[model samples]
Each structure stands twice: as structure tokens, then as C-alpha cells.
Target: MESVVGNGCFRLVREMANIQGRDVFVADLYVTPTWLDPGNTDPLLHFPKDADQKDALIIPLWIPGHFLLSVMRPLQKEIFFLDSLYFRRADGFSSQAYRELLRGLAQQIVAGAWTEKTALDLKDVPKQTHGNDCGVFMIMYAWYFAMDACFDFGVDDMCLLRRWWCIVLLENFGLEGYGRKFAHFTDEGKATLRDNVPPVFRITRKRKLESPMVSEDLIQYPSLQPV
Candidate 1:
């Protein structure tokens, strides 16, 4: 579970080029632990000095068994806290403490001080119906926001979303014969997935899959292909 959350964050950063004309800066997950450490006053040290200049920053928060998303829009002087579970209290830290920490981080990044308060607010983002969907929600939150699109997805859409996410990752990493794996999807379903795809991804050009070597491997995971 922890690995899934970490991979989600990694994929977001690795596939960031899929979002056209966006310069979202994502901090390393390792810095999260340092931020959570109460004794660490210079938690931002792990972040690049110029991170504050980016249009948006995505930070993944993990507390033992849960994950959450924190976005800082420095230009707008606002920090948006998104939790799929909507828990009043997260696993390892009090909501107030976390909120204060976020606010302080935003202030330092944007205003370079703790005296100025930015518009820190918890957004009513989409929620997950199942307990295990938090990691998916975190990745989706980063993906949608980075693309400058609203997240209209919910728990029910996760299965399909997960498939699309896999396709995107595979495509980004230049895995061969990716198109062959989803040959059964109707043009409409394919179009829907394409429409939701970030503009930077060039999936319109069809690449012929000439080899059948990986066909069996793909066949075993038909559920991961779009229906």
C-alpha cells in the first residue's frame, strides 16, 4: 500500500510532460517525513530554492496507513488541502497541526515569513467510497490539477481510471506494443480515454504492434485494458 502511494507520486512526476505547458513542481516524498518531524524547522531545505516560483506544487502526505494530497498555489497565495477520506483527524498528526504546517510552508514559499497568512482552505474535492482508494485519489488529484482540469471522477470511476493511468504510464515510458493491449476497446471508449488524457500526450498517432511475443502477457490483464 505504501509502495502504491509512493509509485503514484513518482508516476506523476515522471509523466509530468503529459500535461501541456504546465510547470508543476513536485517535491520528493522523502521530504514529507522531515516536514512531519516537529523538531525540524527548516523542512523546506529539501526543496529546491526556486520551487516557490513554480505555478503549482504537489506534496504527497502519508501517515502509516493513509495518504493525502496537498497543493500549494504560490501565485494565488492559497494552499488547497485535499483528502479523499475527509477525516477530521489524519493518522499521525492533528488536523490543526498539519494545517498550520501547511500554512507556514506556504507563507515561507510565497511570502518568506510566518507572519503573513495565505488563503489556506480545505477544498471539498472528490471523495473515495472505499478505504483503499485514497492512493488513487491522490494521484488523480495531482493529475487533474496539473492539467488545469477539474476532477469529476469518483470511487466508481477508479477501475477505469486505473486502467487509463496504467496506459498513460506505459505510453510515457515508451513500452512497445501498448496499443495492441487495448485493441478491443471501442472507438468511443478509446475516444473518451483520449479526451481525458493530458494534451501533451500524443496518442493520436497509431503505432502498429508487429510482435505477438507480449500478447499473452497482455491477455492475462484484460481487465486493465479499457472496456
Candidate 2:
């Protein structure tokens, strides 16, 4: 499979795009159910660029809706950007155990190692409450974006199985926990968390850690608007 230039996530999407020869959208949050229509473009093709990087323009589709639904919006709030699944090295604050485990899990999924039931078992790894619907849509949107972007991966590369494992590992290290602990209502994390559970084997109100990120600021990328 192809790897994007800047980060693995970017590379993964780009590679898919290169192979598929299509556009990609990376929504920062969950788009409302009716948000994608003739007046709007696909939610996955827009992304903003950093001064040091050069990627195709990506738009942020911020969903404007009801409070409960908005809470379910993935890109409707601020968020921390970390593609922990494709960590390039062993250094940094990441836990080696979690990294190794997630990498193996991703590999297994790519190899078609698990079943839908197993994948669903790990689906709610982080056990979240606020972003339940948003999380589901985020994963769906990411995969949709990746697929439409036309990268090199197959059903396995960025499949739900791989994504589930990614969330499992993410929760193990409390990465999402910290975000939840201090996140605000409009914050992707809701301003603070009082619970932490295993991503793969837990049941609680909070959304799973491996779930797609929900942040409004990330949606600020201007290219996300319908063209």
C-alpha cells in the first residue's frame, strides 16, 4: 500500500487517492445526517496545510445542529491531532506495549485475521457517551474519504477491524482520557472525563478511545465547503 508524505494517516489517504485517482475529504467532526447533499461536497476531501507541509487542500465540514446531535458531531469542536496508529518511531511519550499491540492488530486486520463479531467486540473500546453517534460517523466518514480519495489500501488496510484495534490501543495509554479530562462542551473532549475503560473489553457511557476524534477547530479548514 502507499504511504502519504507527511504522516502515515495522510500517506495512507494519499496512497489510496493515488491508486484510486480520486478526491479525499478528512472531516474534523461528524457531519449532521443531512449535511452532505447537492449543495455540499463530500465531507472527506478538505484538509488545511501547515507551513512546512504540502498536501492537497482538505476541507473541514462543521455540522451545525441540535445540542445532542451536535455533541455527536466529529469536527464541530477543537481537538488534538495525533495519528498515533502510524507512529513513525518508538520514541516520544507513547507506550511501547500499546504501540506494539496496535501494530500487530492492524496487521492482523489487514491480513483478514478477525471476524465481524470480533471487530464489533472491540468497536467500542473506549466506552464513551457524548460522541457515540459522532464516533460511528467519524469512522464511516474516514473510510469513505479514504476510499473515495483512491489510495492503495483495500478493505483491509483502513477497515473497521484495523480502526477498532487502533482505538483499543489508544485507550490503553489514556491518550483519549487526557483529552476527555480537560475537554470542554465545545471541546472535542467535553472539557474533562471522569471515567477510563479498556477500549476492547469495556462497557460504559463514554465513547471508546479509538473512536474518531471530534473537534470543531479541526473543521476550520476552509476547503470543506461545497465547491
Candidate 3:
């Protein structure tokens, strides 16, 4: 942090602090299809720099009107699937290209999470009866699979689940002061380069976290040279 005294990165320090021991790469919703797009310039999915210790990789996929969840445990050579409507995916959606996309995702994950690949084992999960609850099932699957939690939810829990989600969303977004910006730098009275703090303060940020962050930690984020 001293190297970046007045530059930005204080929040990176805090978020890094929060995730120090936790490890899971939760891909953005609906990103599974991009793996098969050879013409797509997007880079292959990567594990976090500190992904030496990972629990699982969670991905939510939307095929046609339905959404399902896929969790990859690369170390175990296992890819688990949870679909609300367990029937084979509808016509065009079940094309060979789509199957290849999922396989590509599994291959990338296994290669990144581990060193080699074998015949990955596909595991089935409890299915939802309602057609519209695929979104909800997907979310829960990600939650459970990430934590290695059990499949305790079923159709009887649907009503309570929907209402619970409603309350959670409202409480998350409807309340005032719901989202607070990171204020460590501001608290340090060093919000900008113009408000520079002493080197000790910046260096102390790393020291307090008890984690040595080398230049590689911020490879994508070039550190600003101290003026």
C-alpha cells in the first residue's frame, strides 16, 4: 500500500481480507455458453490467483427459458447438475454445440483447478417440479454446492422460499444506507493523491492484514509509482 499511497487499492485490500480463507470462483450468471464460441475473443475462464485452495466452481446456466446450475469439483473430476425440469433440454437447446459448451467449461475448470483430466463423473441432483422455479433452484444449487451443503429443499419449501427471497431483495435494496462505499482511504484522510498519507499508513495496511502482497497480486492493476 505504501507504493500506492494516494492511488486506489485500499478496497482491494479489504476485499482480500474478507476472502482470505474462502475460495470459490462463482462465474457470472449465464456465462456457460461462451466457452464453445471459437470466434469469441473472450479468454478462457481462470481460477483466482490464490486458487490453490478451492471448494468448487459454481455456474448458473440459462438454456432457452430454463435456468439450471452446474458445479465443477475439478479435484474430484465431478460435475454436478441440478435442473428444475429434469427432462432432456428442449430441441435446439440440446444441440451438440450446447453439449460441447458444457464440456469445454468442465475441461477448462479441471485443467485450471487441477493438472490433468479424466472421464469426469456427472452427478444428478433433486429436480424441481415447477417449470418457473428453475431460477430459484439454480440460485439455491449454487449456494449449497459452494458450501458443500445438503439437498434439503423440495417442492414443499417453494412457497416459503419465494417469500423469503422477496424479503431479502427488499431489505437488500429498499433500505437507506443499504450500500456503503469503502471508506478506509477516506477514513485515512487519503481519498486522493492530493490527500497523501505518510508511507507508514499505507504500509500498515498490508501489515495489519498479515498477508504479504507482492507485485504479482496486482498483476492486472499496475501500481502507481509514489510521487
Instruction: Tell me the deviation in Å of residue 79 in model 2.
Output: 25
> 28-68 in candidate 1: lDDT tens per residue?
66567566665555657756788777777777776667777
Winner by TM-score: 1
TM-score of 1: 0.62
Candidate 2 deviates by what RMSD?
25.9
User: Residue 187 CA error for candidate 1 (Å)?
Assistant: 26
Q: Candidate 3, which segments miss by more than 4 Å at Cα?
A: 1-22, 33-52, 87-98, 112-124, 179-227
Q: Model 2 Cα displacement at 86 (Å)?
A: 31
Ranking by lDDT: 1, 3, 2
Better of 1 and 3 by lDDT: 1
Poorly placed runs, candidate 1 (over 4 Å): 4-19, 38-41, 87-94, 112-124, 174-227
Q: Tens-digit lDDT track for model 2 on 161-186?
A: 45653553343325434433332321
Q: What is the lDDT of residue 136 in candidate 2?
A: 32
